[model samples]
Target: MGELIRLEAGVEHTSWNSSRTKMAAGMSDGSVHIYEPLKGTNSDYSCSNRWKAHEVAVAKLVWAPSEYGDVIACCSKDGTMSIWEEIEDAEKRDVWQLCARFADTKAPVLDLQFANCASGLKLVAAGADAHLRVYEATDVLELKHWQLQAEFANAADVREKLERVSCTDASVCWRPATDPIQQQVFVVGFQTDSPQHSIAKVWEFGEAHQRWHLVAELSSPEHDYGRINHVSWAPNIGRPYELIAVSSSNSLSIWSMDIPSGPGQRPAVKLLGYFTDHQPGEVVQAEWDMSGMTLASAGADGVVRLWQSNLKGRWEEKSRVVGS
Candidate 1:
């Protein structure tokens, strides 16, 4: 275990560099801080630089792929998003320069993620408007210029009535690509009273149609988990099926989805486990370890729980850590 390192401003979100050498934290004061480990120390860290990145609290921060250099994206409470690149000034001091800004966002961006594809780097942002927008960098070297590749509603049957429902939050996760031929895929869910808008849906970019298509919906006729709080698509190792964790106000559900063997084929989804021991509406995040063998979930109660499958292949809580 690493030593405890605390921040004064309090961090709302954090993203580590691809190499894990540095971390970018979004503070409650609308500032972004970069921290790097001290030499010969695993736990000790030093804040290398920090700057005010937004006018309001930062809602989410995402680090671009290492191939894009030291670039990070941040969204704020004021319904805006921006991209930053780490650069050295004339004085040889490290600085974060604003490269791109979304000044005309229709609604608050709840979450954002970066994915690498065959064409180039793509970014997906989910908004309180119940829509997911996809953007692609025009030039790999130029972080300032990006083109809106696609924009579509995340849920079905609510495209024209967006004003009737209000979304509080949303979560998104990209499907880990295991093959070069795999197309772009992601899962997104919105926190809203509208039933359709609250369900998690899987989308895939269709190569032939040049648009995104709904591949699957993690829904069942027997149950409806209200207003998804988080969605995590587990990393695929050698498993024949894929695993996805979706959390709501009621329970945390683990699903096993079959991989499509051919193009335009929809995969089948089966509910593997549903656990509701955590405090309702307090579940914050769910993530999988590198091997995709163990699951870790955190809640607002300051408890971090680890879960795994038993010998019978049934998912169960293995351990937990209560934060001080």
Candidate 2:
């Protein structure tokens, strides 16, 4: 069973806060609608606020962890990303205010995500220029302030002399492991105009040098999957390493990474499985369950499919929920 709410016709994107108490929807008319679920009701939701978030259509929205309060980050087709915070005004009322705007892309920001790491909070944004930007805030209360930590391409090593490629779309997912001893890492998938550089890359932030480095390339020249649409890092509670699921035009691939024990060693990423029978059209998004044991994918054909691994560690199609 599912709940449905009538919203404006051109709802583009929506995201729920960490606590799942608030939901934000980005509309095609450059407005954002905030809604709170009505208590004691199963399918009722009320719109609490709405605002003009961007000059153009808002493409993506993500909320920070609850520790940071009710804060949201949005990317728009106007080539900018803005961070907003719901703060108490002088009259003891809550109001949404713009905290900061990031316009370094100068191109439409395709995808962005916030990572709540044990060290601190980090924000990652990918744009049409094929560049990935990372930002960090020194203080959680000071949402307006952020430092651009690193910027690089999605190649194996941006420092190396490689072919130039521009990204058409991008998605990022942070490693869910929060052990302070483990080095922080996140994965990025780039849908590039050029097939040679269309791949998923893993980037690691080094605490010693205070810089970012590319640790792994999950694609090869001969079999580079064309135009990755999304990448999700599954939460691992007992696994020694991490697992990542990637969705491209019509296929989904899963990979496992064996993180090395020392610096200067690259992570070994091995393909676990690939599934192509989920839907007949392009796969738009893929998400893992909280336990990282199950996966769900949505396709352009209006179908939501679920997948899980069996006792033999082989992935199988578990169920399918068709859309109306």
Candidate 3:
């Protein structure tokens, strides 16, 4: 095993900035630590900044787009989320200041993500109540001014209004912005008892209606994955269709989504492939590479596997890393 370095507090979650050169760690003690990579053969990282962010353990942390400066959003188990910005003081010291806080959440906030939309920067927060709240910054220059743009259920079967469900976790991923057109889209999944609400769903912001609408649902006629463990939207360079990877406790699936050419048309979803080789264990997370060509998945088996398409366009596991 590699050398184990002790930490002052137990880390609950970690996230990387858009550039991936900086890392932010949320601790179990309600603190956040920022790390910077060091240039050396030792391949080490140094903690450059640390601050107490919340009164409770942090549940999720996400960095804003680099164009938005050194800003980060973090949510806690207490159903509250706050935004922080790092500024350089006159003394050349790093100072983190609170920009805004959203504490009206009805349930524990499970996920937080920042999307660079065509108009401005938007933040999406998913709670254990199976609801999503979107906040948009009125002025990009000022990170403090954010108004709640819309709030709605993440799944279609969420019922007439917001109903509290026994939800445990939730995952959110924004679609890659590939063109000049500002299309606000994202995929969300919930871990709950309700099978319909637990499956992943794609949502798009209707500019005309000024609200969100469900565009597509990733499903199959053969099997119904009860609860999605994680969801990842691949980056689209110029592909006619979009790719989304969804992982569950016992299986992993890839779905192809049609790119709508006209407005007001719902995108169609087709199940590309599904694999059950992650047996005898539960898959925890799935992520795509920067190129959007390869996918990486981690399971309870303590293995990190990379998957890619073969010559015949068949998705297959390319390689794997076994943790010691």
Candidate 4:
């Protein structure tokens, strides 16, 4: 066994950039380090630029899509979410700099997303207290809008009578592939420390007020998968793009929307796939490539596995790279 020469220490989390040009890592010491990997070499092309991004440990990091340029979104234990974009020097090389600090809440924001922008452009966060707050990102000083999405708090829901299950472990909200209604869709997982089933909810824009409404709820019949981990979009997004999600378990479940056509077309979601292979407790993260044809997953067991469906349309394991 040889050493992992390329390893960077102190990082509590990492998020890959959409362009694949750079990636950001959040350190336990409250710093954010952005690294650009060199092509055809195991070594990075340049020195990592580290900055004090948070007052306490950086809890989660997510890179904005390339359409958003150098911007990155991060949530920290200090109870804030910040968006940073590079300020380039005269020579045009990136000199990473702070773009904007969005908002500070009373509780730590564990997970957040920026996918609603194509419609109304908003920022959403799931805090430790188990509330999902959605905010409009704009030049206006005051928060344009905010709503506590859920609260499953109670004595029975509390594990130690202090922490409860309505608490969210992670969250992801994405726009549907199509824009028939001009409103975005959101999916979130809710967990309480109680004996009841944890819930994953679907939300859509309401008939009036431009407000969001809960449309669907997903719960295990046996009530097992302890915490909802992450929700994601299916690849090859088209009109009403397919949706997919995964949890603490090794399963990858897929869903899709059936938009009605012509004069009357009510929408519906089809369960596309539920894939499970990695050993329990061995899997960590899952992502679909832009095409939705391939999936990448990695976890605690130290393996990065790639999966794909052939032209014939049967899914298969393509490759597995050992993680350092």
Candidate 5:
């Protein structure tokens, strides 16, 4: 029941704008294609433009909110991250231009996400260096100017010196902002060969200290769920605590974290639910619905499964969609 658009180049990653009026696809040949709906057509899309984005394969593409004015950030296999913006030309047509490029990373940038919060616009990038780097933009119009705010390993203990572990991949999800008084927080999951270091960690930006701090670790010693492949923070509309879903090699776990009400109070994290039976192979991705009431996960078995909580607050399988 879905419409398809054929492209000359093979796409490796695709992202849609927040307004849903446009879409961008990253090609396997390190190029990016921009498409928009054709005029007076319902399902037809035309490629508006194309550009070479990176020297290596483009791994990910994410668009900023409309308030940011048609901006996108891309991560590549060449250990570089770039931000591009669409500016109107003299003829009133849009032109895509590179706003900034960051190439200081030692390894490939696996994942990057943008968070437009009350604090400001922030970008978090995870790479093979075993570090989650944060960047902040003071002015919204100046998308090119960004300051490196913080860099830390995905671990609960920040003071201790942790050796650099080879991170094969990582996922970063920003906490949905509901309360203005709540501190800014995001979750990072590291996929590494090191069993002791492979885990999910929640990081919070401390306003008082002007730095970032690791708040909670979302794992237990009793069950070692191998390298995490995906993580998604649900949008909490009325829940007292924040909910996050993380997927490992074969299992998916949902965790609830309570925000501290006062100073010097640490956040408490508890495993709310977990799933392993529904998926026959490794779970590659997990996403939460808009209301945070439902979860959907895709596995290597080529199937999509949905999960929801019952009246008793126990999570159960809701439905399944098989893939060809």
Candidate 6:
């Protein structure tokens, strides 16, 4: 409803984290602004500690696991990521402590995410250069620190078919909010070519085999072209398994991984529910609660919406943050 914090050089992108104590805002001038939203009033939205986070436009912001506390990772147009933390000790005041910083490639980074799935949770990030990188984070001396992790090379065959595919990075998300589901599968969406359209892939990792295997592919059924903006897995409650939901340019679709049909045993994706507010033009962001029971959505219309289901197990608009 009001301005939380205005960047002196203007802002580029912003993300709300699962941890209510933190916020990551990217600036147009290649820096990231970090803040702790104060509870209680008109002045609360403001970020308490603001600083220069990058050398180029910070294109994406992602907060690490809450278990890690105060760690945020940011991607930049310059092909670098900065993971930082706020030092709240009396000696540091409001300054930030740099946990990690490095350049993986020269490709512009677009999005970042952490996987909560089984075989140990992993942190994943993608950039404009068509690189999907995964990191195996370790908790040392009770401090959670992320390393080079691992990098998934570009799909060479897929890149050759599309112009600049190697430079275009994809977005990542995991299926199932429950600890049970998270430990089983990892999902990611890519901006691919026509006919190929966009793709959502599910991967399963074997701890004993020390290998990550491809489980399923959620591709465009009718070759309809809509770039996936984000993907989420609804919390499995009262239900048997997890439900995957993906948001695109103009539509939102939900699929049930529990129900299998046909020979391939592919999951069924139903148009469970969707709403398009013409005024917004586009749906930009979305997320589920920690339990995956509730969903929140935001669009260009500047309205924040929450969706829940009725007794019939159908999704419905439950609440909204309007005109903010």
lDDT of 1 by residue, 159-241 (tens): 64464657899899999878876789999988998887778899999999999988888888777587689999998999999
Please list the Cα RMSD from the true structure of every candidate, rounded to 1 decimal place. 2.0, 2.1, 2.0, 5.5, 1.8, 4.5
Model 1 / residue 77 / CA error / Å: 1.3
lDDT of 2 at 249: 85
lDDT of each: 0.87, 0.83, 0.86, 0.61, 0.85, 0.63
The reply for model 3, stretches above 4 Å from the true place, is 1-8, 38-42, 157-164
> How well is each residue in 72-156 modelled by candidate 6, as lDDT tens digits?
7788778777777766778767777776676755566667776554344466777565556676656532224666555653343
What tens-digit string does per-residue lDDT give for candidate 2 at 1-324? 656566777899999887677889999998899988677864588787889989889999999878888989999988889999998899987689998988777567889999888768889998777778888887876888998888876656534326656667889888885576677788888787676456788889888888788898776443446679999999887887778989888688888899688887888888877877654687788999999999998888888889888898888888999876
TM-score of each: 0.93, 0.92, 0.94, 0.74, 0.94, 0.76
Misplaced by over 4 Å in model 5 are: 7-9, 158-160
Residue 4 lDDT, candidate 3, scale 0-100: 26
Per-residue lDDT for 1-324 in model 5, tens only?
A: 776567666788888897778889988888899998888875788898889989888999999867888888999988899999999889998889998899877678889999877877889999887788888886877887898888876655544236657888889998977866567788888888876567788888888898888788898766768889999999998888888999999688989899788865779999988778545688899999889999999888888889998999888888999986
Please report how far candidate 1 places residue 187 from its true position, in Å: 0.6
Provide the clashing-pair count of each candidate structure.
0, 0, 0, 9, 0, 13
- On TM-score, the stronger of 4 and 5 is 5
Query: How close to the true structure is residue 243 of candidate 6, measured as C-alpha lDDT?
Result: 67
Q: Global CA lDDT of candidate 2, please?
A: 0.83
Instruction: Show pairs that collide, candidate 2.
Output: none
In angstroms, give how far residue 284 of model 5 lies from its true place.
0.7
**Arranged by lDDT, best first:** 1, 3, 5, 2, 6, 4
Model 2 poorest 10 in a row by lDDT: 155-164
